[model samples]
Target: MTQTKKNQQPQPAAQPKPGSAFAYAPAPESRSVVDIAPSYGLFIDGEFSDAADGRVFKTVSPSSEEVLSEVAQAGEADVDRAVRAARKAFASWSALPGSERAKYLFRIARIVQERSRELAVLESLDNGKPIRETRDADLPLVAAHFFYYAGWADKLAHAGFGPAPRPLGVAGQVIPWNFPLLMLAWKIAPALATGNTVVLKPAETTPLSALFFADICRQAGLPKGVVNILPGYGDAGAALVAHEGVDKVAFTGSTAVGKQIARTVAGGSKKLTLELGGKGANIVFDDAPIDQAVEGIVNGIFFNQGQVCCAGSRLLVQESVADEVLDALKRRLSTLRVGDPLDKNTDIGAINSAEQLARITALAEAGEAEGAERWSPACELPSAGYWFAPTLFTGVTQAHRVAREEIFGPVLSVLTFRTPAEAVEKANNTPYGLSAGIWTEKGSRILSVANQLRAGVVWANTFNKFDPTSPFGGYKESGFGREGGRHGLEAYLDV
Candidate 1:
C-alpha cells in the first residue's frame, strides 16, 4: 500500500459481537463494511468463554487504528484449562477412525468456502493485508489445506508413517500474524486429520480471524474441546508453549522467539515444530525475461506487504541486467494501488499494527543512513492508517540493515552479482533460510542454483507461490519442520 507518516489516526467505528463472522459483500453501494467486535472470549471446550482473570486486550485495525475488538488475555491457568479440555477430548477424538476426523475437516472446509467473503473481510481488517490477497490467496489456500489434508485422514494407513502411527495428544499451536487463517489451517488441519486435538494461539494482532475460525469450528459441529482458540499476546503464547499438559508445541513466528521457545521446551516431554522468520533472496539473472522478471520481483517482495516470512526481501540481480530490471520494477511498482483494504481496487493495504509500522519505518531510515538510495512509487497513503509504500533500496551492500534484517514491510534491497557463486553467497548470507526465487532461462542454471541454495523452498521463475500439497517452512535459523502437504503430518504423528 501507500505510506503514512506514523502519527495518523482514523475515526472510530461500531463493534460487532466477538467470535462472529463479518460479511462485507453483496452490498448495494460499497462492497465492504468496517466491522468491529466486542469482548472476544477464548474458545474452550468448543464454546466461547471469557478468560478466568477477566483480562482483555484491544485488537486495533491497522487500516484505521480503530479498536476492532477486545480479546481475552489467556494466562497460564487458562492455557492449562484448555490443554486439559483438549487432553480429555483426545481420548475419544484420537480413538475414532481417521475417516471420521476427515469428515470433520471436510465439513470445515466447505464452511470456509461458503463463508470465504466474510472471512476475507475480517482477515483484511485484522491483519492489514489487501482484500485481494485475503480473499483470493489466503482464504482459498486455507480451504485447500483442509481439503488436501482431509483425504489423508482416511488414507493414513498408506501414508508411509506406518499403519499404527498415532496422533500426538494435545498439540499446542502458535501462529504468526502474517497469514493468520492460512497458518491456522496449516497447523490445525494436519493436527486434527491425524487424530490430534489442538489448543491454538493466534497472533495477538490478527486474533479476529482465528476467532472467526473458532466460530467456523462450532458451525461445522466439531466435537467439544477438540480445537480451542485462545487469543492474547506473547505471554499467552509462552504459556501455551511451556504448559506441562501440552504434548507438542508448533509455532510460526520470528527466529528470535523460536530460539526462546526451543530453549524453554527443550528436554521436556513435548514435541516441537517451529516455522520461523526469513530474509529470502529473489535472484534475477541476465538471461531471464525482463518483463516477467520484473513482475516476479515485485511479487516476491511486495505481496502481503512483504509481511511474509518467505518474502524475497533481498534482490540479487545479475550486474549486466540490473539497470533494465530496476527500470521495469519502477514502472511495475507505479501500477500498484495502495489504499483501503476493503476496496476491491486496492492493492496495498495497511501494516498489521502501529508497532509494525514503526518497525518498518525505522528500518527504512536505517537503509537511508547506510547510503542506500530509497525509491518509492508515487501513491497517496491513507490519511488515517498504518501504511507503508513499496520501497526499494538501490546500491545496497550486504551489511546494510535493509539487506540483512527482516523489515517485514513492502521494502526491498537491491544488490548486483556478476556470477552464480556470488549470487549464491549473497542469498545464503542471512541466518534465515526459508525460501528463495531464481528467474533464469537456463534450466541447468536453475537446477544448479536451486541445489546450492540453502532455503527449504526455491521458486524457479516464480516467487511467493504456495500450494497445499507442497510442504513449507524453513531450515537453519528460519526454524524447523514443514507446515503443508503430507510432510506436515509428520510433526503431529507419534511415529
Candidate 2:
C-alpha cells in the first residue's frame, strides 16, 4: 500500500497553493439542526417506556467524546415485552390488504425523505461518520429502500414466490453500528412490506437514528407494535433472537456472533438470515484505468472510515502495473483531509469508538510485526477523539494476518498477482465471500473474472455502489441470505 509522490505534475494557478491565504475555510454543517433529548427510552408498542430494570447507558459523539444522550438498556424482560407486543400486532397487520399496507409503507418513505436531513445529522453525531456520507450516502439510500419496498407491498403475488405468500409472524432483527438507519431500513422495510411485524435492536454504540426512526414511524401513522425499537447491548440482542414469539431472526454483524445465532436457532422453526463480515478483494488488472482504479480503491476502503462489512480491504493488483497503481494511490492518500465529522471538507472522520480504534491499531501493528511494509500520510489528528490515519500495507500476502483478518478500519492491505488465474486464486482464498470488485476496461475480462469469483456480489469497474433494487448478501463465512431487491422479499414471506 506504500506509494511515492514522485513524478507528479504541478498544480495549476487556479488551484490553491500549499500554505497560501487562498486555502479553504472551515465549512461545517450546523449541529443546531438536530435536537437531542437529555434521555431516551425504548420504543415499544408505539410508545416509549423505560427498560424493565431501569438500566441506562450514555451514547457519546465519537468526534469529540461528547455525551450525546442517555438511552435505556434493554434486558431479557424488555425483550419479552417487545416480542409480546409484536405478536399481538401481527394478526391485524398481516390481515390488512396488500394495497393498504402499501399505503403505510409509502407514507413512511415520504416522511423519511422529509426528515432525512435531521436524521442524517443525528446519524453523524452518534455514528462518528463524516456528515457528507451520512447526508449523501446513508440518508438517500434509507429513503430509497423504503420507497422500493413500498412499491413491492402489493406486488408480492407477481414476484413469483407463490400466488399468495403468508407473512412470518414476528421478526427479531439485530443490526450493527456501521449503518444504523440504513440497516434498519433494510431489515424493517422488507419485513413490514411483506406484512410481518418487527422487533429490532440497533447496535449499542449507535442508537439515536433508530430511535428517531421510531418517531418517523409514529409520524407515518404506522400501526402500534408494527415496528419496535430496543436500544441496548449484546444481551438484549441475544434475548430477542432467542425469544419464542419471534418467528424469524435476522442479524447483521460479525461472523462469530452470526454463528452463535445460527446455533441458537438450529433445528427450530425460526427462519433465519445473517449478514456478516467480509474481507472483500478489489482486483486491478494491467489494462484498467490507473486513475479511475485509484479513486475506486480509496472509495471502497476509506469510505465510512473502512467500517463497512463489504469493504475492499484487500487490494490485488496485476504485478505489471502494481508500481503505477501504488504510486498513484499514495499521491491520492496524501491529499485526503482527516478531521471533523461535521466538516464538509473532511474526508476521514473519527473511529466509531475507542475499543474499535484499539482493535484497528493492534491489527495494524500485527501487519508490521508480520513483515508487511506499513505506510501512512503525515496527517495530524484531533486530540480529543478516537482517530486513526488512513493506512496502507505493501508486500502483503494471503498468509499475513492483516490480509486474512477483517480489520474493519481505515486500513488497506496491498497484494499483487502475475496473471488472471493467480488473481482469481488469490481473491477466492479468503474464507469470507461477501463482495469483490473488478477494475478493467475489457467487459469480457470483467465478466470472466466475476463469474469465477466466490463472492455473492461482484462489482465491475466500480466499488461500494449500492442500489435498493439490487440484491445484496454474502456466501460462506460471510453469512447467508440476501437483503435487497426482490430476493430480499423472500426472507419474510412464507410460501
Clash number for candidate 1 = 2
| Per-prediction tally of clashes | 2, 1
CA error at residue 258 for candidate 1, angstroms: 0.4
TM-score of each: 0.93, 0.96
TM-score quality measure for candidate 1:
0.93
lDDT of 1 by residue, 350-435 (tens): 89888889999999999999899999988888799798999999999998999999999999999999999999999999999999
Off by over 4 Å in 2: 1-22
- Per-candidate Cα lDDT values, in order, are 0.88, 0.93
Model 1, residue 376: what's the lDDT? 99
